[model samples]
Target: MSQNVTFDDRDQSVLNYSPGWFLTGTYNATSVGQTGTLASSSITNVNVTFVFPTPATEFFYFGIKRCCGGSYLICIDCDPNDRKFITIDAVDPTDDGQSPPVVLFSQKFSVAGVHEVILMNQPDPAFGGNSQITLDRFELTVPDPNAVQPTSATSANLFSTPTPSSTAGPELVGSASSSSSNLAPILGGVLGGLVILLIIVGIWLLVRRRSRRTLYSEEQATAPGPQFQSQWRPNSTFTTLTTPGTTISTTTSRRELDAGRIYSTYTESADDPLPPEYGQVFNTAGPSESSSLEPPPPPLPLKASR
Candidate 1:
């Protein structure tokens, strides 16, 4: 049967149906049906209802269960165009042989005032069955705008305050400066060690040159005099004194003392001539002048030549 019930903002109602055929469309099932199938084998009826209000978004649900039936019954849903009306698989109850059935449908329609909605037998063509569905109770409620949902807890309602900078403190800046200052001593120590090494090497070279000069002086003092003259080895590679006609063998140990003063004494050889200063001493082979056998001369009076 087809039925209709109009609803507004404040009012609510329920529709009643019976076992015999009638013409009713959509209405509310807020209350129990009066004259439909009760919990017994004598009647099997089906009830459907619809509701309309001001256009709004809403949710809908329904309940179906057996009041009483001898057979194991079901409430299966089927496509509207199928021939055989199918019921869902039923569970047999041991206590009262009653099984509860539930079918729920929902849709949102945008229309202003009273609008017509349809509720059908679903897969019904021949339209009458002893096994029935009964209307219990339903809800058509509107949600409030101000009501909080679960998402509100984690949402960012507004911008959060910015966190302070990590390096804002002066103590952190001071610590960095102090770290660089601590490295200064280590850098200075390394540079100081390199300078000291250079100075030590320079001092060692000066000491070594002085020691060589002292050794050369000692060697010159211990050398033989010109009476027992032996040729001295040349210390350096170059020669200084040269005679006009004679090829003179070079002497090494003689050094210039001052102007017109030489630390050298000459020895005459038969092969080479001597200078004029050593003329009497050069070839006096017997009883040379101022021999050791000659007497000492008388002492003269001392006078200052002024």
Candidate 2:
């Protein structure tokens, strides 16, 4: 249901209508000239009463045009038993084209009742003239009950679903497998390098050991034996007899004798006996008669002849 209530200066019956609505205040019914192609008036402390057929379950829009004043105070007493009051201040617009109707109150009613609307004007202290409130129109509207109310449930469910995350798990697993696959060549390369390094180190160690063994063998082969080492001395002189009549003298320095050479000395004795084999050969060549056999006769004859 919709209703538009307008106040015209020519309608004096609108001021005294008490069956459903009435107005009481100090107001000039037709004082100001026509404002914006409609009759306008100045009102102060005006109280307007409205009786609805049933409870007001919709919204009320009030159109007010305020002139030069301090401020306008408007109050709506929607329920007298519960008595919930809504107060609003209406200020003059900067220009006429910028002004629009304002919704005074929107509520659902419990029972059919009467609502009171009170308007009061405050004078501008600086201007010090008569303060007034101009009313253009009032509209009451009831909305359709069967109209669907919009909600965010469908939009909220779009974010709450886990469809994208179901595929994310497999993607992460595949990434891990791919990462392992990529690292295989790198690990193999590092291991191969380490094996090559170990082989080179082994070859180097074998070569070093063989070289050391070869050096030790050469030293052992060239080294002096015990017999040659016994000849070395700090100070020594050597004389070699080649024959009975020849002699060779060798003077050895300390540095030269330290070379670890061999030296030998030979000596001959006159009383030294020959072996038995040499005696038997000499006896075989000469006579076997002993000196004691025929020695007396020979000794007497030799003395007589002397």
Candidate 3:
């Protein structure tokens, strides 16, 4: 499916020459887009532009009539800058009136795209002011539209031939940008995972603290405390409710009086005053409650007999 598209110098659409060009050659075989700018003011070169179709071409070849020709520059998708162009010069011998058309300049490109090949007519530096050239025609290796394309795997393994391009830094810059894009999501995932772990730890600590406080409260409520016991009997013989040597609160002593008696082993004389500890108890007691504490009424004497 490889094909060649040839453009004769007569084709005005392909080659754009500056002010010094004159049409002076046969049809389609050889022509002139050359300029004698050694002593001229016009500073532009001849440019051949090609618009490659869908399946682009990979190489170009230019046939020129070379006797005293200078150099042709190859620039792909770039403006004419003499500082950055591929130089292609044909051999120039000393005495030459005319010569056959030879491939003076040819180049192959790695990437297929729009290309601009410029031909600047500077006389050979060796023969300053004595160099000249004749433009014949150019050919482009284009692919057929119905050509069978390579499979994906085959394309991946295919390496485009190295080209004389000076625009190499942009590719490396693009690679660095893609690497940065890939790292962004990984960093975000790490940060998100750390935040989730912190929340879980906080919740666990809160639950542990509340559980400790609840257990402490339950223990305090069920602990042992003070105790009290009592038995009430109205109109009975006075009896001591508190154990010997044990102290009784005033509230308990008054409750005993309400049941009709308050007993104490503090009697020293029949008319002696009560002890200070018992003074409040007797002073507040009713006469019936006080008399219940006295010895039981003597048995009534029998009527005059034994």
Model 3 residue 292 distance off true place after TM-score fit, in angstroms: 85
lDDT tens per residue, model 3, 1-306: 677777766666756666675446432322343332111111226444444433345555544434554555556556535447666675465425333455766667665556665565554565454444456666777766577667744675554443545676877567658879999999999999999999999999999999999999999999988776656645344333354566333222222324334544444666767554554444324543433434434333223221
119-162, model 2: which lDDT tens digit per residue? 44444454464544444444434333454423455566545644
Q: What is the Å distance of residue 220 in model 2 from its true position?
A: 99
For residues 178-211, write the lDDT of model 1, one tens digit per residue: 8789999999999999999999999999999999
lDDT of 3 at 168: 61
CA deviation > 4 Å runs, candidate 3: 27-55, 79-83, 94-98, 152-306
In model 2, where is the ten-residue run with the lowest total lDDT? 297-306
Clashes of each: 14, 0, 0
* TM-score for each model: 0.24, 0.29, 0.38
For every candidate, C-alpha RMSD to the true structure in Å: 22.2, 23.7, 17.0
Candidate 1, residue 241: how far the Cα is off, in Å:
99
Comparing 1 with 3 on TM-score, the higher-scoring candidate is 3
Top TM-score hit: 3
Sort by lDDT, top down from the best: 3, 2, 1
